[model samples]
Target: MTTAVFAGVDVEVNEEGFLVNSDEWTADVAEAIAADSGVGPLTELHWKVITFCREDAAREGTAPGLRRISKLSGVGMKDLYALFPKGPGKLAAMVSGLPKPQSCI
Candidate 1:
């Protein structure tokens, strides 16, 4: 485990920098994570995906992948790719402060 300071709060993280505890997640932390991801900034659309990823992870015991996030998040694949860049599911899951999906690349 590693300690990552975000929003002036220290939170635990995995070797990959994904949050270790969902309880440590905050909107401020999300924004910091998003910023650190080089995704520019967190827009409304970005928030939507972040919220969806967190909620889905809470219910499903794992963060949803790109396919599910695109299908159920009310955000399209093109936009997700554009907003998150690189990998939508992976980045969003990281920013949402959930466990990196076992399937994320």
Candidate 2:
């Protein structure tokens, strides 16, 4: 798990939560997420999907599944699977500094 402050707000996350933000996120925030998620070398596409997942989770209070992520990011499930082969894409998204899921609480 990793943590960072985005928009002057503190964000805590691990591998089992949802993405949260106190405000609309920016590219800098996404970079921070990538650094925290243990994917410091994340590509632009990775940032896009990860950010989308975080925002969606924050809005819905639930982590978006791979299918939703694919839809929002315009990335295929197979491609997402290749990126997160461990089957915890949501967790990875959380680790990138998303909010904790309601279920987690």
Q: For residues 5-94, could you state the per-residue lDDT of candidate 1 as single tens digits?
A: 988999999998799998999999988888877876789999999888888888989889888998899999999999987677678889
lDDT string, candidate 2, 1-105, tens digits: 555464465665334433444343556665665555555656766766777776786788776666667767787877776665544454445544555434421
Q: Alpha-carbon error at 25 in model 2, in Å?
A: 8.7
Off by over 4 Å in 1: none
lDDT agreement with native, every candidate: 0.87, 0.58
- Cα error, candidate 1, residue 8 (Å): 0.2
